[model samples]
Each structure stands twice: as structure tokens, then as C-alpha cells.
Target: MGYPGLHRILWTREQFAVFRDASGQSYVVDAYCPHLGANLSVGGRVMGSCIECPFHGWQFSGKDGKCTRIPYAEKVPEFAKIKVWPSCEVGGMILVWYHCDGVSPTWQVPEQEEVASGAWVFHGTTEHFVNAHVQEIPENAADAAHLSFLHEPWIMNGVDLRHTKSKFWRFMKHHWKAEWQPEPDMHCSCLIVKHSLTIFGKHFPLLDMMISARQIGPGLVFLIFQHDFLGCGVMIHSVTPVEPLLQHVTHRIYYQRSVPSIIPKFLLWAESIQFERDVMIWNNKQYLSKPLLVKEDAAIQRHRRWYSQFYSENSPKFPSQNTGLDW
Candidate 1:
């Protein structure tokens, strides 16, 4: 929580108010005041242990969002309460647990030792509101062909089999391997992908990239990227579905404490260049379900299988209406 910090956020298509008490204990609740439907976040003031609605001075308990005091009334009605979400602070972030079935969290967000050991510090955050589904964003992590063609255009000209003109052969030419791990005990999955790019008929050792990512659920992805020359860093990619075809995606990056601040800044700058390029395609490209696959593209389906385990049985099997073969 920051100064005068009554943070208002839109998540899961609903308004929420997040604030901290005098003791620095954080709480998140529905933004609307239950009495008169006034938005609590707009003019609400935090008292010692309650949030007072500016409209009528009605105070709600910070712990449970139950109406604690009514300035005008002697008795507080039982219905004068709002939904209080389960919140916890982890890795310098306030995470609120959400379940569609009104159930408690089945699994907790894993603790990252890097954050606790003080070996890493928060660099910065980059956010993008993509006009695409939430699943598409994580799928890009395993899509290596797009990295060569879109992120690094120079590599495309060097190794593309334009003259040979075999689609399957060309797809297999990209040097990439991805593994998906579903840990039953943890109730999560980790995706490890390693790939190298060729430049001018020679592979630069520094250009090799390895990514280790753990998917906490459909909404949270924690990833660490390592390169031979650029060093290693961790990024938390949290995606929230604002609507059916829209998402609020945030990338929070942290770097080693020993490295200079400028190095992290430069790394993020270079990453943003490619991220924006991917955004352009993600916003426009159609989703395909039974997409024709080659040997190199096997990771896409493997990752999808692991992803589907997160959704409930009532949820649609395919998120997009345009999810058939492109041809």
C-alpha cells in the first residue's frame, strides 16, 4: 500500500477495493457499499480497523467486510455485509484468491526463495490489455516458431526454407524442445522450454534461451528466463480475464541484486520490443484447436493438455469460437 492508497481495481469483470489498515494489514472487498450501493473505494476512508463509507459514515470491518458500526442506527443488519476476498501478500505483491464455484483455494501460491532471501529486487512492471483470450498469452511461451519469425526477423531470412517450400520440413527446422510437468502433489504444472536461434548460418552460443515456468492456475504464470550472455531473471505474468475476449495482463520482472540497475532496465527494454511485436499478432490472429502439428510444434498440444486441467468441467472445452483448423 502506498500513500493515500485506496487502490481500486477491476478484476473478473467486477470492481474491487484493496486497502491496508493502520497496522499495514491488507484487505480486499467488493467496491460497492452494501447499504446504498455507493462505491466504497471512491470516497471511502480507512479508520483504525474499519473502512467508513463517506456517504453515511457506516463503517465495515476490515477483517471480514461485515458492517461493524452504523452511525445512524443502533443495530447493524445481518445483510449489511459485502464479499471479502481471500488475500495474501507474497513476493512484494498482493494476491487475491478467486474461485468460480465459491470454494476456498485448493492450492496456495508457492513461496519463491529468491524474494525471501533478498537476493532479488523488484525491477518494474509492464502491463498490456490484449484484445485476446487469457489462454493465448501463455501459449506463446511454447510457440518457438513465432520467436524466429516475429521477434527476430534476421533469423527468418537466414534459415527459412523458402526455396524448398515444404511446410512440415520447415517447421521442424527450428531448434526447440519443450517439456511439460504436472506435479500432482503441488496441483500445478511447470513448462520448461529451451531453444536456440541460428544467425548467418552459425549458432551464437549467447543466443540460446531456456525458460522455466510454473503455472499456478489459468491466471498466474511464474517464469524464469536464462540466457548465456544476458544473465537470468524472473518474471510473474498474471493474466485476468476482464471479459470473454479481453484480458488484463501484467508482467512483473525482478533481477539479481548484484547486477546494476541499468542492466535490468536494458533487459526489459529489449524484451518490450519483442513483446509488443507479439501483441500485434495476438490481437489479430485466430485461435485454432486442431491445428496441423509438426514434430517441433508438439509442445503446443502438450501445454494445452496441462492447461485444461485447471478449468472446471462446466467450462467450455475450447475458449474461442474460431478454434477449428485454419484450412
Candidate 2:
């Protein structure tokens, strides 16, 4: 939903091991081989169409988990079975379902026409990992209060945080949005969010937090984020589970420039600098040390409230706890 690019976000969330195998052509597979329970991802290698298991040179095709060839098997033993997930990259980001029961339901990846459309300018993206949860970070989009503390509102074209308006937005049962009215003294005169589409558009209304910052055009966006639950934390990409208190975080930033003049690029640069500052703040957060909500933490509090959807520590589905790691 942020940018049109795929990222193989290999992350350790909740102490689980996950690998987002994002190639120009997208195909996601369970990191482990179902047959011998080998960590295919650890020694898994990708060739033309097959993902080669480092153990015994067992190779499985990414297309349908078909064992294309087993070097030692006469005809690929019948027991050489592998479960795979067929994934694809449209609009640059790879999309995969996270149903752990091995059921492929009717799920779709976050996509927007402006992502790769010619009308908008698309700048390549950067991938990063945060020590939080995906469910927790997306709420930042709707958070207006944190701008004052986490990000320099003055640098944001002088957005007057004191006078900004906070409104409730519901884009989908799973997504939410918020809008902050710009103040006269603020830098950016207007603050609009245009992402998170509902069934149509009206049904789901997410204030699109800028999608990209590569160019200035009708479609150009500044910041966009779509969860690539290719493997556990957010949906299924978060494979780690330490003690239910801690989790791993991996994220990708698909930013773009909106203005036509050189100013957009400058803004992009400025945003990059600010991103570093935000990272330091978020990383150092005592995530395990839960805090009671406060007025200043309105947006962060909103994030916590939104994340509560999956906040149940007793969900039947827990991390495999079988990543062969001694953490």
C-alpha cells in the first residue's frame, strides 16, 4: 500500500524466524520443509524457478511447492513433500496470506493505482526493522499528537500541532485513519491522508499518510506502508515468540516526492533525516514496560488501542517455538 516494491524482510518477531523472499517475481514458501522439518530458509537458495534446500540438495519449485528434482532421489521420492505459498509482486510489494492453518483464504495485498502509475513519480524504497509490532506502527499514520515529540512539527512545513484537528476515521474493519486540520501558521497549509481504501472508497476511509516522495505529480505520495506478512509478526511474518512480552519488528519505507520543483526532493531528504531520529526514539522505547495512556500519547495510545485487536496473549496460534534457536 505504501510503494510498489517487494522487500524480503527477514525478521525475528516474538523470537520467531521469518524470511520475506521478495524477488521481482514473488513466490513465498514456508521457511521449513514439511518433510524433514528442515529450515529451508536457513540454507534455502533461489535459482531460476526453484528454491533449493541446502540439506541433501533437495530443490523445491516456488511455483506450487512441487519438488522439481531431488539429486539423490531416483524420481524425487514420494515422501519429499513441501508446502508452498504462491505469492506475487504487483506494485513493487510482495503480498502473501498469513493463515497458519495452511488454508489460503480470499485475502488481497494492499495496492493503489498511484503506486506505479505513470502519473505519479516512483522512487525506490528503503527497508528497515523496528523493535515493535506492525499492528503498533501503522497506527502512527493516524497519530497526530506524536508529531510534536517524535517528529519536529516545525520541520513539517510548520504544522501547528496546537491547532490541528483530530478526527475519527474508519477505512475497514482492520484499518483506521485520522485527519488533522492544518493551521494558518503551520508550514504545510493542509494535512490530508489518502491511503487505506475501504470496500469501495467511502466504506474505508484512511487519511492517506503520504504514499511516496519521489516526485511531484497528481499520484506522487510521500509515505506509504503495507504489511508484508510474507512469513509472521504483523499477520504471519512474525515468527518469533520469546515470552509474549517482547516481539521483533521489520518495516519498509516506500517514500516519494509530491511537488514538481526541487523542493520535493529537499523534503524527501529532510524526511530521511527525521526518519533516523524517529528510529532512535522508537527503538529505545521500553516496549515491554507498558505505559498508561496520556494526552500527549494520543496517537501512540491510538496505536495501542488499534493493536489490541490482536493483543490477546492467549490466541491458540503462537510462534512455532521450533526455529532450532536456543534463545
Question: Could you tell me the TM-score of candidate 1?
Answer: 0.82
**What digit string (tens of lDDT, one per residue) describes model 1 on residues 1-327?**
573357888876578888888678888889899778888899899887678788998888868889988998979998888889898887678888876667797778876778667787889888888887677887776676666555444322332223223433343233556676666754577778776666444676667788888877777877787876666778887888877778888777887887777877775665565566677777888878778889988778877887766666444323444343231
Runs of candidate 2 exceeding 4 Å displacement: 1-9, 13-24, 31-48, 53-57, 99-106, 127-129, 133-136, 149-153, 156-264, 288-303, 311-327
For model 1, the stretches where C-alpha displacement exceeds 4 angstroms are 1-4, 152-177, 185-187, 195-209, 227-231, 313-327
- Model 2 scores a TM of 0.52
* Local accuracy of candidate 2 as per-residue lDDT tens digits, 1-327: 111121233322311112333443556666666657666657566666667776767777666677878777678766565655545454543544443344553433334455445334444334345554333344444466555454522243322333222222222222223353322322111224333324323543332233321211111122433322211011111113223323443223333334343433443454554455555555565443255766755556543443344323333332653321111
**What value does the lDDT take at residue 320 in candidate 1?**
40
Residue pairs in candidate 1 whose N, alpha carbon or C atoms collide under 3 angstroms: none
Clashes of 2: 43
